[model samples]
Target: MSAQKVAVITGSGDGLGKGIAKRLAKDGFAIVLSDINPDTLKATAAEFQADGVNVASFQGNVAKREDQFALVQHAVDTFGRVDVFVNNAGIEDVMALEDVTEADFDRVFDVNVKSVLFGTQAAAAQMKKQGGGSVYKIINACSIAGHESYDLLGVYCASKHAVRSLTVTAAKELAKHQITVNAYCPGVAATKMWDRIDAEMGKYMNTQPGEAFEKFSAGILMGRPQVPEDVAALVHYLASEDSDYMTGQALLIDGGMVFR
Candidate 1:
């Protein structure tokens, strides 16, 4: 195994995932970035390489069990050992709870919940092989929706709630293996997800674009919108030895939006 830690981050081609990959790379990990979008994956890999960071890119859908396994194996193949796995690839579906189709529910759940489950399983298997010790971390991408159910975001909320549950259960089960499982619950980061959310909620609420996002941001005690870097900082902690003792916890990194 290589001396430097290896981190495999899903959906890291852009948005919060990209930020997490960058921050972790800055902290000296050899990064393996994955995304379903091949173009985005190539672009992010190039950007990281330009900054003198060691990075490899893979294009795979996070919702597939086979793909999840491939991501972990790719890390091991390229970097020798896997130290961190970030299940950050997720999508949002903003529809009225009443109007939500079974298909929509399955898609959202598959990407947000199922991906984390299998992704964690895949990573843990490798971490255990690397000596069944707390030398590895599994971080899930949760959201404020996981904490509180919102109107149009019900399905998305449910999916994240499942993520939170999985994080706890995986932490407990993987503890003997010395693997830490945790999640970062971000509120309203100004990413493309929120931009799409703003537009979709506008359609449901009969409001203008940006209004829903503004309203949510207005409620933050910090009085400002969260950037991707805010979430990345929390991830940096979770991925480091500083958080070795922390697991099974879904930390709220949302500008004080929901106090736990």
Candidate 2:
């Protein structure tokens, strides 16, 4: 309703989500940053405020439909319209096929697959009512482990493959309503989630974090790792007019690692 465009980004407390929010803000969208972590949410919101970017903050778990619904609600209430919704809040639990626990699988699916489903649904409803807007999901490069397989990361791979499928399906279903659904698949980016996981895994495996991070980036075609901002740029393009004609596609932003 406001003249300025509005963008609601989840997991925006840090890393990929924060980067996407920042980029979209620069692209002229008022930002609503959401995350389950309250301190981080406040901190991230402060960033946009300091830069004089129109911004708001909310704390909620993406997996909860009620919470997810409130996310959009707050943005609309604060900004008066929702022009873009970036469902970037997701978690992955790296586990071996045989060692995968029930809790581990559920945790990954709840946020990565289920939350994405509902987040898109909620945003699409708003967009459909308002005529149209863009919905994007920032799914990490699961292609390597997804298309093929890497050791101890099977669950994460499968969850991302599910996300890939979901993105295209939503795109096709929502296109008729003038809403576009797309995904940015980043290859081993330096997000907070990845950093924490790398540190934990490195300690467990008796390897340096650099060694682990290097091995992760080795699979990419560029052989150089990705930073959060790299993925954010693609997210910006996907959420903008330039990509209006593009929908139902998972655009790989993974430094060419997953391409055949």
Candidate 3:
């Protein structure tokens, strides 16, 4: 049999990751699920299998190079080649500048930035061998914080800003090889991550999780706070042949927070 389009979505066993993986599978891209969560990893794979989509799973810590290497290598070994890579695994640290410990900052950078670097390196090596591919980094809804500042999320914003910078740099650096490196910065999406952020940062919405979620629909001019599937739809587009001409851009999927 000939090779099918294959995508490896890191941290894709649940939430946004799972949504992206399922979308890719539906789009006919063979889906390779990677996450630190082994049980969810297998469950996602089996679920896709039941749907008759080509699927597989790999468990790896995003902060580790060897793990990243294995995931890319497995993509090649199992599916012939990788056509897309999504770096979607991340964590948030909600402490002020002074309260943010070195260890905490390091941990955030390790997963958010370092992992993407190595993961991109691994994907690029393979993509280069196979001609080229696309890489998408799913950055959180960093609020105005990514560009400005929030009360207790300096570290988280810093980490995302780092990812944003790295993405632009990679776009320019990788263009020559036909590898498109880009990031999707979605504003506040109602997910587990958002729930955690809300709990730590206090009532940004003045309501509980569900209540707050509905209240904070949009910032000034932005449409609304997003859902995982909302971001997933855009990710689906970027991973396809339709976005071949796009590269080296930080496409903001947020409701207009940054421009405001």
Model number with the top lDDT:
1
lDDT of 1 by residue, 1-260 (tens): 78899999999999999999999999999999999998888898999999999998889988999999998898898998999999999999999888989899999999999899989989999999998344589999999988999989999999999999999999999988889999999998899989999999999899898999999899898889899899999999999999999999999999988988
The top-ranked prediction according to TM-score is 1
Candidate 1: segments with Cα more than 4 A from true spot: 132-134
Per-residue lDDT of candidate 3, residues 142-248 (tens digit): 23345655667788788878877777787788878887877777777777877877676564435454654454454525566777787888888778767777876
Question: Any idea what lDDT model 1 has?
Answer: 0.93
Compared with the true structure, model 2 gives a TM-score of 0.91
- Model 3 TM-score, 2 decimals: 0.88
Q: CA lDDT of 195 in candidate 3?
A: 80
Q: What local lDDT does model 1 show for residue 67?
A: 93
Query: What TM-score against the true fold does each predicted structure earn?
Result: 0.98, 0.91, 0.88
Query: How much is the lDDT of residue 202 in candidate 1?
Result: 92
Candidate 2 Cα outliers beyond 4 Å, as residue runs: 132-148, 203-206
Candidate 2: residue 82 Cα off by (Å) = 0.9
